[model samples]
Target: EKRTLDVWLTVNPADYDGRAAALLIARDVTERRRVEAERARLALALEQATDAVIITNTDARISYVNMAFEKFWERRQSDVLGQPLTVLGAEDPEIVFDMQKTAMMGRPWRGRLRHRRRDGRTVICDTTGNPMRDEKGDLVAYVFVQRDITRELELQEEYFQAQKMESVGRLAGGIAHDFNNIMTAILGFGAMILEKMESDNELRHAVEQIVTAAERATNLTRQLLAFSRRGVAQVRRLDLNSALREMEGLLRRTLGEDIELALRLDPADCCVMADPGMIQQIVMNLAVNARDAMPRGGRLVISTRAVSLDDEFCRTRVKLRPGNYVHFTCSDAGCGMSPDVLARAFDPFFTTKPPGTGSGLGLSTVYGIVDRCGGHVEIESEIARGTTVHIWLPMVEAVGEAAAPTAEEETRGGSEIVLVVEDESMVRDLAVRVLSSAGYAVLSAADGREALELVEKLEGRVDLVLSDVVMPVMGGLEMAESLQEKYPHIKVLYMTGFSDRDLTERGRRVPGERILLKPFTRDALTRRVREILETAKKARTHTEAEPS
Candidate 1:
């Protein structure tokens, strides 16, 4: 191959020899040119790379840093060229020592580290260091490639939190399922005993208190279910003002005289689709949280209004949509939360209060309830300033004339053959007592399997089956399915504390399945049974009257 050459001329000898001759020397520089081009290519590649690149001498002194490193470290190249590599990210002494030892052996070291930037901000990064060797095979330098992984770590934390919540949900759901059965017996027997007591009897008041306490216990379990996202919401178009009004006295009593509980009700009705009991629980939790935050007493303001959110407003927030919404706000002038505390306010079992003082599910349950109701909750707080929680729920028109419950209707009952299926002995006895007192022939079973045998041998005479959804041997849904095949005329009612999602997962096939929650009052149980029995009788009469 032909190639161009670098040439040099020697003319001094010609001058000395009085214009005699000149000598020329030529050398090929192709290899030198190719090496320079390769070096340039590598430098350009390092400059444009996204991951940070740093070069340090064997002594751990920084020698060169790429553009990416300069930006990522928030420093100029000149500022860090002669500094120790430790200045870049030696937060963990052990990690740095391990990396140094590994690099010295001409090996590679990789790790995730919390590194401090030049600007003093800490960041999580995935970093790798490889030893660079000279032609003699002696280590000369160390090359480091690092990537900012703060967002990745955050995503991983969120995923872990989600997994944790799911685990907590399952655990809470299971506990609540069994606990509900126990509470049912407590509340049911309390109500039944109180019903038989004379109004003037001294024991009547004590019995009434027992029933009240049982109801409160039931409420607590429901809150736990809410945190697990397994609690069902009985939604209604409710006036926020009315609900708050009803809770004012209870809230006042709970907050005590030192804390001022103020209600800023809207002039116009603030109607939203929500579960009334769940909404009350939300207010109760928030109020209790505010109370705990202000041990010295502070002003707690509960307000409601109708607000219109535009697309622009919705764009800046998550879990929000542009529409008219009922804005419910609870603001408290109490010791506020730090950024760290606020960030994890919705994490289950995460609490700032002393152990046993709080279950730490207050805010998490509120978050779950608002989310389930197609709403969003936003919280704002500063270190010393107070905190304000803003909840926005989609507004709806006021529902037409809701009939108030009368005393007569509350105690109403019916004559029907009702089968009660529950695994708990106390709960089964309570159900039998309540139904028998309500003029119904009540049959009891310890489990669904036993209930199935009872219904089968009863020869289609059972008018309704009020059964617990979960039990040993067989579940309520399975037994109900079997009953449907054998005695299609029988009505079924499923009572459970499990979430709707759980019910579906357990293969609930009854269309529009009716589920009455646990710890239901005697009146509630009797009224529901009568309603189902009446509906069934009317259906049977209609079917008989129809041309078959």
Candidate 2:
């Protein structure tokens, strides 16, 4: 209906008629201009879109693709246009067919789908498609939008896994705490009976057996606590190479002659801050796992090196930061795991080994330990190839070195006064009995509140406070804090069955603070008390000797 017109008017010169002539030229460009404007708008929209956009004809052949689509598929638009939709390689052909069917019916389709890139990598996408129609309501084409959701899906899985583990850990921690309380009484009474009996007495053997069994049970509880991330870690600066070398002989014996064990230490020393025993346990667990994987006989390689992870490398991992790290790797040439098995590898009590053959706690324990130490773990495996596990622990600039022990035999008992505070009756009784037997004057209380009252009444007479960290109405840390303010000279030894995180928000082991973990042996209890008493005595003596 729109047109461009050019018109001219001419006057005829001549005598008689003085005629006027008009000439006109008209051009219609309504459809051409309209199409040009639409093309420009569509091109701009496609060029600037963040989501992958694809336009396919009614026949399911690609008519056009946006820049985002090209980037996503790693393909050129010129080569892909007019090709079949199947060229994108749908992860599930049925899903693609269903989507096309729904769109052809003039209905919209939305779902999670996978497509393969030109490089052979598959991408997970939240895809949506809608049919485009002409003014007469006739279906012409379908427009699809896709957004990459690979990382989002990974994060979601991690979140759910963490929640499940946390719930399990809470249950495990409560059980371990109660078990420790029961075992303490069992072991303490058993030891006392054995100590009173004659060397040749028959009852002595029975009591000794009970004590031994309790010790074994204690080991199981410790593992439970470790998996719950509640066990206190005695972290120290470590030379990973030295530890691995020391473990070599033990590993060989454990592996047997059929399996070969190889150790390749980093040329540069890899130093990390971790519990020495725990680090050893990590290596041992991994090696044992590898040994189990290669039942028929295979080569196991343990290697260590220093590594630095950057921002990009750390992005996909949860709770990981970019920094210097010590890398420890354990690889086995054995039967590998399937993807389904690999995804649940770190879940608690998830094991493939037959009944009683595995506890399903080994890998889960490893995950908990590494997570507690501010480290990360990665696993890679293929069906026919092999499995490799990589562990990274942050590196620190400096760590305290332990002093060498003196050769002199020191007494393991002392006459210092100790206040025992615990809510658990059996555990409190055990502590009282142990300290009393070790020549120490022991005062007992049912809880921190009672301990505080006793301390107040004792008025500087109580030389040391040995209190449980958790209790009703009050806790050891609170009692200790009050004591420090009132009687700064008094030494406090806090004990707990709870994990380090429960004791402190930071989950840090405070320097120079004495803490004893529960379910301890009489000897361990006596030795620790003696050490703190002696140290306190030395400090008091030094203060008195100072000139005013």
Best by TM-score: 2
Give lDDT for model 1: 0.82
List TM-score per model, in order: 0.72, 0.86
Please list all clashing residue pairs in model 2, or write none if there are none: 230-499
* Candidate 1: regions farther than 4 A off: 1-48, 55-123, 129-133, 136-143, 199-202, 235-253, 256-275, 301-331, 337-356, 367-383, 386-411, 444-462, 472-474, 497-513, 534-548
Q: How does candidate 1 fare on TM-score?
A: 0.72
lDDT agreement with native, every candidate:
0.82, 0.80
Tens digits of per-residue lDDT for model 2, 416-469: 788999999888888998888778899999877788788889887888888887
User: Tens-digit lDDT track for model 1 on 67-123?
Assistant: 988777778899888777666655787786676667656688899777676655568
Superposition error at 188 for model 1 (Å): 1.0
